[model samples]
Target: MRPFHYDKPATATDAVTNFRPGAQYFAGGTTMVDLMKLDVMKPARLIDISGLEKGRYDFIKWSGKSLRIGALTPMTKLADDDKVRARVPMLSDALWLAASPQIRNMARIGGNVLQRTRCPYFRDTSYEQCNKRKPGSGCAALDGGVTRHHAVLGTSDKCIATYPGDFAQALVALDAVVEILGEDGPRSLRFADLHVLPEARPDRETTLAPSDLIIAFSIEDADFPRSKYLKIRDRESYAYALASTASALRMDGNTIADVRLGLGGVATTPWRAREAEAALRGGPATEAQFARAADIAFAGASTTDENAFKVELGKRTMVRSLLETARMEG
Candidate 1:
């Protein structure tokens, strides 16, 4: 990694106060350090906030109706939580399937959700045509570059890099709220609104400002016992997903009373398939209905030559997740 100054703040207020235009918060450093070593991100200073407020940001609070998880909580803690595993298996499963055991042990939820894309053109400096890395430079993946892992659902002519996180998909599906501590003060917003589509500006990924620090994530209704996260990848383990779905259902006899759908590994952002959920709600919880909903989910997808198959793969992943979730005893 390039030489950079480091600072450890004792509290959130101090961290925010010390923040500068070229400073980055260091938590678990699983993602930031990797990018730094690769020279993909070169910050002037690293503000270490891992021990801020004497670990006040590391916690899990679950009520019968809602769940609040601190941003600094490690992935392994949340994934292994008894209540989270039993009541909200989708969230737990997403965390479990996100990375290896070592990575899970060190990665914080706040950093995981903000992890950058793994697109080859974006990660490697050799390519000069990554719009995400250098705006207006054009996208190399569009010009006969390998695009097997690129996005199809939210692709613009300027970029097709996919958002490669599993937990964020669950958060989007469950309508979780993200709490933030920024320069102005504390604020919260829908997790769905946290990430922005790469429309005209591929370099701009999230809606967060430079000094915004995520404090926690809250789910209003955490009783999704009939929820599941299904991921499809080139390999069985230690690989990024090609397409994945987070599905939750509320059944009323033979009909679907409520449905939630969030897609990952196939979109520009942690995708919430609101259109698909609308189609499945109040409909029969059958393969036929699920298949129809899946089709509606990818109806607006734009694909490249190598990533065209993702459209079909994404649909199948969604259908399977819905069917499997519907079969759950809870």
Candidate 2:
């Protein structure tokens, strides 16, 4: 951590009011602080927003038709909520299967979704060819660097780093909307549109403005009782995913009435397999259909020698998630 000014605003409006260029909002500091320590990110000032809007933003509201979660709500709080687990189990499972218990206890949902990629090339400053770290420089990972953990989908020539978060995948599958309060006031955007693919501008990861403060996430029709988040990794616990899927399925006997799929660990963003979901919808809930849907999901995948296996692994993960979700009690 280099020398920087710190400010803790009393309210959300106050926090946005004090925002300036090169200033970063600090909440859980789980991801930001880690980067700051590594000198990967050096904001001129840090505005602590964790204390702001505690009563308003640090909450979880579940209406029968919808659910709204405060941005400041801790990962553990929402994951352990009986209502969330019973109704939208995918959301709970994603959070539960994320970082260790200590991290979940303090990590807020807003920051979790906005967390930076864990690419070694981007994090370690010694590597001088990271487009995400320094735009126009180039990507070291694409040039024969260790890419076992890099992305296989939504990858551009400029960057192949994967979005390393579980909760965002769940939100994408559920079509959650993110509410934002910026210097220009408030607005809402579809969660699916929040993260842009790393095309030419690899440094620009999210669509959020520098001063925009995420207020909360809202989801309409939050009644996905038959849902699951399945993650495959090198280890069983406390590890980043290699290929993961968040699946929510509604079955009409043996036929799929509705389906939603969000893929993680194999993509540059929280990936919504809309094509896969379309193929599964109104189809028989069987391994053959599931495999076909999986094929459609990875049809546009671009892979490297080190990470090419992600295509097959990602497909298998999605198929397994759908199978597990379909087996859930109605």
Candidate 3:
């Protein structure tokens, strides 16, 4: 890692004022530090914002109508929160299933959502053709590389790097809103719109401005007691998802009153399956309906030779998640 200046700002305003082109905000440092060691991210300065005011952006609160989670809140804290576990079990499950105890203890919710892709070519500096690593450059994974872990959905000719986070999927499914504080003051955006598809400029992953600081996430309360996060991976634990789904449902007898779905591991970003949710809403809550919804979810999936199986796997994962959620007592 290159030498860099470090600054710890106690307030959000100060952090934004201190932001520069080559400066990066330090929260959990799980992603930033790892990328810096790999030489994938070289920041000239580190602005430590983790010590910001606690009540402002470092606490989790449920206001009866919605859940507000501070951006700097540790993953473990969120996972273990009683209210979160009871009300939004899917969010808790997503956090618990991610990384390990040590990582979850150190990783922050904001940084987790903003984590970079785990594509080998993108992380390895030796590979000079990673479009996400270097804009306008070719994508080595697309040409010839180990692509079983790459994306099959929301992919483009420019890049096929898979999003490698769990919490974002839960947030997307719950229709969370991301609050931001920037030079222009504060604003909020849909969580689903935070990440950008790897189109022409794959290097530009998120819609966040350089000077913007993620403040918190707001998720509206709903009758989604029957919710789950199901992740299928190569291993039983401490592994990234091969195919994952976050399923939340509200059933009126045997009919689905409402549903929300988010897919991970097989997509370029935290993919909200709006189409699938639409198909399942007000429909019979059954295996057949779940399978049909899954089919619609992966309908537009594009894949390469090695990762093509992800389409089927992702669909199956969604179906299983929905079925499991449907069986849960709400």
Q: Would you estimate the TM-scores of all the predictions?
A: 0.99, 0.99, 0.98
Kindly report which residue stretches of model 1 are placed more than 4 angstroms away from their true locations once superposed. Answer: none
Q: Give a tens-digit lDDT track for model 2, residues 134-250.
A: 999999998879999999999999999999999999999999999999888999999999999999798999999888999999999889999989999999999999999999988
Residue-level lDDT tens digits of model 1 in 91-194: 99899999999999999999999999999999999999989988999999997899999998888989999999999999999999999999999999999999
State the C-alpha lDDT per candidate: 0.93, 0.94, 0.91
Model 3, CA-based lDDT: 0.91
In candidate 2, residue 195 scores what lDDT? 98
State model 2's lDDT: 0.94
> lDDT of candidate 1 vs native?
0.93
Superposed Cα deviation of residue 306, candidate 2 (Å)? 0.6
Global fold similarity of model 2 (TM-score): 0.99
Alpha-carbon runs more than 4 Å astray in model 3: none
Question: C-alpha displacement of 160 in model 1, angstroms?
Answer: 0.3
Model 3 pairs whose backbones collide: none
